[model samples]
Structures are given as structure tokens and as C-alpha cells.
Target: MLTILDKYILKRYLATFVTMLAMFVPIGIIVDVSEKINFMIENKVPFLKIAVYYYHFTIYFANNLFPIFLFLSIIWFTSKLANNTEIIAILSSGISFTRFLRPYIIGATLVSIFVLIMGFFVVPVSSEGFNNFRYTYLRTNGQQAMRGDNTDVYRQINDTDFLYVNSYNASSKTAFNFSLEKFDKDKMVSKITASRIQWNPADSTYTMYDYKKRTVGALGDVIVREPEKKTKFGFELEDLTPVIYIAETLTLDKLTAFIDKERARGSSNINIYMVVLYKKFSVPISAFILTIIAVSVSAMKRRGGMGMNLTIGIAIAFGFVFFDKVFGVIAEKTTFSPFIAVWFPNFIFGILAIFLLRNAKR
Candidate 1:
């Protein structure tokens, strides 16, 4: 079922893509180390931890540039084939352009599958390590970075209870001006307020200062106060203070569950999380479109040769990245649809690929 030509092109396709990743990933690591070496040293980070961090960084870096590298590799090798007139000779043997594209399609399918696995499962673990290392060692406002929007925090715990905090400090595991209100139907049942609350991780309990509880009854209201009180709450610290990068650290199923939980809590960052989830699927899908465009752009022997083709290819690749980032930010910040933001780049470039394919066939 396999021909020599299919095997040859597929070999070149996969081999070149691997080589590109090998080359660029190391360079990216070096640049990152150069920038962060002083920070690592200042924090007295151990060498082994640094090594592990870069291991995770390698996956994160490669995943981010996967589509770009795949596009460039395809362009580079296919341009070489064109320059050698190998494509012309192959076409003269009566193979249709669509048929000639079969191996490339197969190669794209393979790469897309790998991308899907990496995006949905592997990259999340790497992202957690990469971001945790930065927040723990390199960032100045590490607590603020780890705990998103520590001020004016609010959460709907369940159908009957709601919570509010004026401010939280992740470093100290403390919250100020905390309140929990429980409702029975449309009426308030009881409300608890604390001037300060601190988690005692040693005993898995919370110590509150100036704590007060007010209960509403049919006859009247009853109130109890204490200067210092220790008790357990229904929620954990994470429920009160979720990290900004929590979405990036969760795998497909966990991410989906987290989104559902956040939705129930009426979180304002739903759009941002939606963008991340959509991109996990969209990034892999772009591999197919990028491969098609790369082949169409580089399959013809142009007057400007491989360099010209590469220039064009790189421009298109960056333009794709630019669109992706812009739309993603718009979705995250404004009310734009995350689905459109994630997939619009592929849709636009898909049209470009079609036009270029027609010209290449001519």
C-alpha cells in the first residue's frame, strides 16, 4: 500500500520537523537561562532543581512553537525539493497535485495527533512546573502572582452560603475582614464575621480574631462574640484563593471540572479560562492548516529561491501567531467569544492555503 515516493517525502517531513525542534529548543533554553541565571543564583536555587525546571521548560517552549517549527520545516524541505526539480519530475509522471499532497496530509495527521496529546496532557504538567518555578523563585510579588486578585475576593460557596474577604495574603495564609452569610430561602439565617482569619496548617484549623456570629430567629436576633476563636470551615484555602495560573496547570478533565466549578462560583475570569481550554484543541488543529499552507508556499520553484520562500513562510507564521495572541487577549479581556478567538487564525489562513494551492497547481 505504500510507495517509494510516499515513504521518501514522509521521511523528510518528519525528520526535518524533529531536527528543527532539536535546534530551536536548546537555543531557547540557553536564552532563558541567560536571562534567569542571576535570579536563580540569588535565590540559592539548587542545580538539580534548575535542571528539572529546564526539562519542563523544554516541553513548554516546544509546545508553544510547535506550529511555527512544523511550518518552517515543511517549507524548508519542500523548497529544497522544488529547487532540485524533483517535484517537477514527480509531477511529470502523471501524479495529480492532490495525489502528490497525500504524504503531506499523512505527515500532518501524525504531527497533529502528537500535538493533541501534548496540549491536552503533557504541556499542563510542564506549564505548572515552569510557572511555579518563576513565581516561587524569580518573581518579586510572588504571593500576589500565585493568588490572583487577593483584594475584594468573593465566592458563592453553595446554594445557601456565600463568602467575602476584603483582602488575603498568601504568604501569611491570612485573610482580613472575612464574612460568611447563610440564607434560608430569601431570608438570612446566620452571618459570621471575623476581623482577621489565619490558617494554622500545622493543625488544619483556622484562628479568627474578633469573631462574631449573628443568628436571625422568629422572635429576635441572637449574637455571640469572641476575641479569638479557632474552628474549621467547609472550604479550604484554595477555595478562597485560587492561583492565577491554576487553569494552565490542569489537564483536560481537571480543567473542564475547574471551569464548571468556577462557573458555579460566578467567577469573572470565565472568559480567560475558556480561552485556555479552547486553545488546547485549536493549537493542534492549526497543524493541518499550517502544513497545507507550507506545502503550497514552497512547492513551486520561485525566482527568489529558497530564501524568498523562507521569508514568506516566516512572515505568514508570525502573522498567524500575532492573530492568535491578539484575539486571545481580546477574548480574555473583553467579552469576545473564546471559540472565535482561538480558531479565527486557522480559518483565515485556511483560505490563504486554498488560494496558494490553486496557484501551485497551475
Candidate 2:
């Protein structure tokens, strides 16, 4: 079932992909370092931390653009094969074009599995580290970036309980103009108001300033007030308002669970989180799709040779990235379906690949 040609192509497939990653990731790191070196120095970031950040950056960078790298590598090597007449000779020996695609499919399957694993497990960890380091060290207002939004926060704690805060301070870990309301079957049962609320981790309680509670009863309404009060609540402040990038920092299981929790809380950013979740699977599928497109485009020898193939490959790759980003932004900002937004690029390119493959076959 094995052949020398299949082995040769598969080897080149893997080697070229790795070579592209190796070549570009360092250049990415260099560019990033040049941009952030002043920030790192200003913040007095430790060298060890810097090294670790770049390590995570390498994984994050490579994983993000892996499909492009893969597409270019295939085009690079296959165009060489075509230009050298190796493919012409092989085709002359009676191997059909479809048969020539077998090794490519095998390579795509292998890379897809690898990409899936990295997206699900490895990339999440590195994304956390990469983002954390950037926010903590490189950003001028790192605390604000790392913390959730500060103004007009609202959350549904559960079916009957809801909360509102006028503003929150990440540095102080305080919420101003905090209000909590409880309802039983659309009738307000109790309301709690505090001018300022602060979490006391030492006692695992909330310290409320100018606190007031109002209870509604059949008999009448009763009100209680205190200048300062300390009590425990069912939720934590951080849980109510997580950082925007929190989804990217979680592994597959944790991300799923977090999304479910956020859905229950009626989060406004659910689309953003769903986009992130869908992309993990979509990126792997893209490996197969881009591989087919790359092979189809480069399999035929042209007058302009590898350079022409590369130019076309780059244009196609940029188009794919452009579609992905535009749809992703639309999904995050509007009511667009995240699933469609994530997969639409692949669908468009998959059709292009089919047309190109048919032409190549002809």
C-alpha cells in the first residue's frame, strides 16, 4: 500500500510546513520585541518572564497563522516539483491526478489532528500566558485591560435575583452605587442598595457602605439602613465581571463550562465567547481545506513557476484571513450567528478549492 512517491511527498509536506513556521515565528517575535522593548524596560520586566512570554508567543503566533503557513509551504514545495518536471514524469507513468492527491490527504489528516489538539489544549494555556504578560507588563493601563468593564455593569445572578452597579474600580476592587433586587414571580420581594461595595477577601465578605434593605410584605413595607455593613453574597465580584479575554485563557472543558455559566447570566459578550469556541474547531478544518486548495493551485507547472504560485497563494491566504476577521468582528458586534461567521470562510474557500481541483484535473 506504500510507495516511494507517497513517502517523498509526505516528507516534503511536513518538512516544508515546519520550515515555514520556524522561519516566520522568530521574525514575528523580533518584530514584537522591537515594539514592546521600551515598555518592558519601563516596567522593569524580568528577563525570565520576558523569555517565557516569547515562548508562549511563539506557540500562539504559529497556531494562529498555521493554515496560511501550511498553504504556502505546500505551494512552495509542490510548485518546485512541478517546475522540475518530477510531477510531469510521475503523471506520464500513468498515475492519475486523483491518485497523486492521496499523500496530500494523508498529510492534511495528520496536520488537522495536530491542529485540533493544539487548539483545544496547548494554545489555551499559551494564550493565557501571552495575554497575561502583555497586559501586565506591556500595556500602559494594564489593570484596566485585565479587568472587566468599569461602567454600568448589570448581571442576572439567578432566576429571581439581579444586580446593578454604576461603576467599578479594578485597582480598588470596589463597586459604586451597587443595587441588588430580588423578585418572586414578577413581584419585587426585597431590594438592597449600597453607595459603595468592597470585597474583603480576608473575611470572605462584602463591606457595604451606606447600606439599605427594603422588604415588601402583605402587612406593609419595612426598611433597614446602616452606615457600614459586612455580609457574604452568593457570588464574587470577579465572577460577576470577568475580563473580556477570559474565554481565551480557559481550556476546552473550562471554556465550555464558563460559556454555559455566562449564558445563564445573560452575558452581552456571549457571541465573542462563542466565536472563540467555534474557531478552535474551524481552524483545524481549515487545514484540510487550505491543503486541497494549495495542492490544486500549485500542481500544474506555469510559465511564472513557483513565484507565480506563491503570489496567488499569498493573495488567497490573505483573502481567507480577511474574511475570517471581518465575519468575526460582525459576529461579535452584531446579532450575526457565530457558527456561520466562523465557518463561512472555509465554505467559500472549500468551493474555490473544488473548482480549482477540477480545473487541475482537466
Candidate 1's C-alpha runs over 4 A off are 140-232, 236-243
Tens-place lDDT digits, model 2, residues 1-362: 75999999999999999999999999999999998887888779999999999999999999988988999999999999999999999899999999999999999999999988988899989987887676567645444333343456777787888888876654356878999999998999999999999988788899999999999999999999999999999876655343456677778998899889879888778898999999989998998889889989999899998999999999999999999999999999999999999999999999999999999988
Model 1 C-alpha lDDT per residue in residues 150-256, reported as the tens digit of each score = 46777777788888887665547788899999998899999999998999999899999999999999999999999999999887675555445667778999899
TM-score, cand. 2 vs. native? 0.82
Model 2 pairs whose backbones collide? none
Clashes of 2: 0
Query: What's the residue-level lDDT of 85 in candidate 2?
Result: 94
List of clashing residue pairs for candidate 1 = none
What's each prediction's TM-score? 0.82, 0.82
* Local distance difference test scores for all models: 0.87, 0.87
